[model samples]
Target: MPGEYGYPNLNDNDWIWGGTLTDIETTLTHGIRWEGSDATRVNYMPAFDGMFDAGQVAALTSHVLSLSGKAKPNATGAVLFTENCAACHGATGAGLPAMGAPALNDAIWLYGGSEAAVRKQILAPRHGVMPGWKDRLDPATIKMLAAYVHSRGGGQQAAPAAEPATDVAQAPMAETDG
Candidate 1:
């Protein structure tokens, strides 16, 4: 009777209901009646069990490897960052904590360091809540923002990539005393 709750087959006492219940009764035998009709009627399958094929696994692994190193700056990416992200995240991707910005250079990611994770973050910024600490602590006792940012395990400063030679004018040099 419990299985009659909103189940179309059970509502109409259809053949499917009788067949399924019979099958379950035969399989579970003595336990079926006391266990309730719902128990015997449920058909469960995991959301992701064996979802990915071998090709998908290989592609995902390769994508992860690609994001581990410094991201190659394409002109479009550079322009997009400058216009949208440079104000908060520095031009070099160093995060500014005053604005609650997080460093993109680091391998240590709060949510996840995967390429997919990064893409999701860019698509939707995280909005976390914290209690007001201004009334609880003195300004001098507040922790250094830079140190906190560094403790998050930011990536090492990567050297600039070499560029192909192009025509350039030589600048007049001013000698400086040591």
Candidate 2:
């Protein structure tokens, strides 16, 4: 189960970053928000304590719950979510793997799924940090770890390769982490 101690579940498809072999390798090498590694995958969801009032937070929480069919939908919550969360979580709350954002439309949640849990998270989000193992483990060991993790039931297939451009004038855009 996820959120047992702020760590994600490796056995489920609701990956916060991604579930590919390469993605797992990268995460194990640099870690997620690890202070020791400059290449650590990092992204922060700003705390909304000061940004929203009690009622507003409740509305937003309800809206988030509604995404997973756990609560009644709130129009104000929808607007608030669009204005504040769409950039990273996507317009439909599907999430962006590149941005390390978790999908909210699914029933799978990193944290608890209750109304109170959602409200607390809305007020003050918690960000988990995973330490990099590159310094502590050899490349082969890391590869093995990646392999083991990839064998989990939730592991995803590698993304399809992009087609090469025939036009020299057209160059592939560089993708950057958020």
Candidate 3:
């Protein structure tokens, strides 16, 4: 599914992946966790069912829900979140893009944002995957698509032009190696 996952606009620099044109191109060509791209990206949040007790999960959910001011702060939940989730999702739940985590402080979510939805996710994590287009599109065409995407309003400024290096000799590689 090419769903935007409720993320902010792509052209405005809010990227789980980097926002450079090359970064966007790589994402499009390889896809995330899809079999087609030789270098597909893949990361997943672990399900915390057995990892945390019901009480702890409840607390974390409370703290996370409270981030959007949807729930009142619960000391137990706040403590649990600080100890367990602060690593990937900043202490304030701002989310660390390098770890493929999304901000929880904001209402935006890949999954629904209700308490029930949040709890279910904690108990059973879900990961979204994008299929790669390299197998279906030529590099030239893919570059064209990237250009169009980069032209969007959310697109960040392109990196300064670098000296064109001689094309590194390379040969076509197999897909799905491993």
Candidate 4:
């Protein structure tokens, strides 16, 4: 009979004694004589267990290096937008505020000023509600709508001029409604 360990079972009489000779021999040879039994157990050696190989490590290192400082987009303005922005902001960037879209052309920015900030906004889509213009307007109407918006300066603009220090110091107070 085959033992659970797959070694053939040997009767005691098969060896020098009547006891199960294979088990006795194994116990004596490994457990007692040389302590080879514990060493032969698969779980005893962790190095043999495969996890991350050399190629995988190298690939991971290369990926990390590649991502370092190379993620900034080269595309900007309409080109940057049409390829990336228009889907949410509308072709003209009029913004679908009802869809949480803020008009990009307007001076108002929910986040803040700076190209970096705008880039962040472009990378992450904001969720909001808006009436589906598709349902309300036909394709030709939508096209005309986009054309009208584009005519009204639909792209990004140059950086705003800096305010003179004196102007900044004497800036008028904004009116407040009571």
lDDT scores in order: 0.35, 0.79, 0.70, 0.32
**Which lDDT tens digits does candidate 2 get at residues 1-178?**
3346578888777778778888899999999999989999998888888998888898889998898898898999988987887667766677677678888888777777889888877788988889999999998899899889888768888768733212211221222211
The residue ranges of model 4 lying beyond 4 angstroms of the native Cα positions read: 1-76, 124-178
On residues 32-123, what C-alpha lDDT tens digit does candidate 4 reach at each position? 21223442111111121133354433332232222222234223332434433344344544543212233454434445434444433334
RMSD of 3: 9.8
Off by over 4 Å in 1: 1-70, 133-178
Worst 10 residues of 1 by lDDT: 169-178
* Residue pairs in clash, model 2: none
Ordered by TM-score, highest first, the candidates read 2, 3, 1, 4
| Estimated TM-score for each candidate | 0.37, 0.86, 0.74, 0.26
Q: How many residue pairs clash in each candidate?
A: 0, 0, 4, 4
Error of 4 at 112 (Å): 0.7
| lDDT measured at residue 6 in model 3 versus the true structure, 0 to 100 | 45
Better of 2 and 3 by lDDT: 2
> Who wins the TM-score comparison?
2
lDDT of 1 at 133: 32
Local accuracy of candidate 1 as per-residue lDDT tens digits, 9-98: 122212221223222222233222233333332211122214345444334333332334644435545544544554554454544432
Cα lDDT of model 3 by residue, 48-91, tens digit: 88988888888888889998899999898877876666665656
Higher-TM-score candidate of 3 and 4: 3
Runs of candidate 2 exceeding 4 Å displacement: 1-3, 161-178
Candidate 4 residue 93 Cα shift, in angstroms, is 1.1
